[model samples]
Target: MPLGDEPVSFTTMVRGREIRYDRDAINAYLGRLFTLPHGEELCAFQKQLSRGNWDIPLMTRTLLRRNGGFEYSAAQNPLRVLRDEMATFTQLLLLLVLHNIQPCSHT
Candidate 1:
């Protein structure tokens, strides 16, 4: 697979269930997502996740569509890029927690 060149249609088996997704629709949705403001997109996604109204394919589409509130990188592995963003967020969260618990003193 190459950047911006996903299969138009694909199928796979998951947990004994067959799944199919149209990459065209995913791409269209991604295009629309990118048009929205950064905060708006994330708020919408968070709301959806809280409602537990998402599936693997839907999540996949959303993750692939996201670019961490920055310009789309056109990376070969969008998922990996998303994972890296998640790691950064996790680290930031840890730092926040530690800061709150143990404030740093000025040198």
Candidate 2:
């Protein structure tokens, strides 16, 4: 865990692990994805699915039919979807580490 401005950011003393938040990094990744043609539309659709208001089965079936027979299992799909949603959180920690945003030690 890591300690920082964000309440969600903290450093786990027991494991000496750090966790940080970097919104910029996440936005960058989203920007890259949004730059692709029809990316924004896909993103909106994903958001609807995230809200649990859309039928994932119907969406998956349509995607499979349109984009070949490739299909993701329920278990795999949820995890993948979660990872995508948490991309910002993950990038924040990664950026913190890359920038050496560690707490100072008092000896």
Candidate 3:
């Protein structure tokens, strides 16, 4: 449990290294510290991907006619592709945390 906007954990011990490391704790702390902000990052990345070479934000600078209706820009790729990429990224991120799998980086 955490206080309003406390941004700290209530489950951590003050003086020792002992702590809960079960599936429940992992589930609880998914947003605490040992996690990547996949949802937020993916949204930004998807927007970047969608706006790959565009200078403006997509859907914000649409053409507004005299009738106050706007025409959306055509998408380079189907929205499904972005959804699939985001889903795969999220799934792999969660799996890594839940399974305690170490991510190996070649870089």
Candidate 4:
């Protein structure tokens, strides 16, 4: 992302068309991409990111929609871009493993 491509918001704010979703939708989306233990629970942030989609102007992605909308990226695998869910997944892994919390993605 360029320096001023998107407004810098310290807090979570929808300045433009942003993909917002509830917990259920987040779980449903990420559940397919990753497999977790049978009884593990994904944190609030993890669930929130699973349903996230980003579309910055002037940047073209194979699946990023030209026009920001509520369209789901169900067909687009997040691991390709190393954004959104990847960061969230990394955070989850770090919190669990580095801190010795027993990672949820553990097989």
Candidate 5:
């Protein structure tokens, strides 16, 4: 587990070489990604995904708000599409971690 506001760091071996993944760079990338108008909602969804209790459809609707229904096609909305892709990637990564298929060694 990471301390409050601490950049997450972990190590994994691939092809007999250890690789370190530090979240500082990843966080920078994510920070840039969330600079759009729907950044808040996307950030909330990202946090929810991190906690393993995300609501995808609700997030989709929230991102494309209009009269309590989606105002646009999700495929046409980059933010919504990104949310979905992030959710999928997060879920897959979680499964990999849980299965020890891509073990992340804490640094």
Candidate 6:
């Protein structure tokens, strides 16, 4: 569960499903967020949200990935995470986001 650690394996009960988890995709996202002028924008946006003020325009822009893919929620529960039909990219992103937002586990 450490940062940058990849899942050891994935299992599913169904067949004929496509699941892709490209580590490069995640690294690319982080790289862009850290290296570009957009980082300031991101920080400012997060600050605005933290202040309880909603920015509809910024929310719309934040939902799209750099590759032009739209962001969507993926189930994080172990049972649903094991499903073969889920989009791997969204699942990974959700995991990363949740990790950032959630408190550290004591166990």
Top candidate, metric lDDT: 5
Give lDDT tens digits, candidate 2, residues 1-107: 33675465422334665533355555565675324365354566687767767566564454333333223577654323332333354547656866676655544
Q: For model 4, how does the per-residue alpha-carbon lDDT over 13-38 read when each residue is reduced to its tens digit?
A: 27665554655556676885454668
The per-residue C-alpha lDDT of model 6 at residue 4 equals: 75
Scored by lDDT, model 6 comes in at 0.49
Q: Residues 1-107, candidate 1: write the lDDT tens digits.
A: 23596744465669998676555556675675334575464567788867755464454444443444223346722223333543455556657877886678764
Residue 44 alpha-carbon offset, candidate 5, angstroms: 1.4
lDDT of each: 0.53, 0.49, 0.49, 0.49, 0.54, 0.49
Per residue, candidate 3 scores C-alpha lDDT tens digits across 1-107 of 67688755535665887577664687777855444476553556687777665443333223221223223447543222122323344546657876676556544
TM-scores of the models, in the order given: 0.17, 0.23, 0.17, 0.16, 0.24, 0.23
Q: What TM-score does candidate 1 reach?
A: 0.17
Minimum summed lDDT over a 10-residue window in model 1 is located at 76-85
Error of 6 at 22 (Å): 43
Error of 1 at 11 (Å): 0.1
lDDT of 5: 0.54
RMSD of each: 17.8, 14.7, 14.8, 19.7, 14.4, 17.7
Report the C-alpha lDDT of model 5 over 1-107, residue by residue, as the tens digit.
Answer: 67999865586679998776655545665675324365353566687667765555775554432323323465643222432334455556657777786656764
Clash pairs for candidate 6: none
Q: Is candidate 2 or candidate 5 better by lDDT?
A: 5
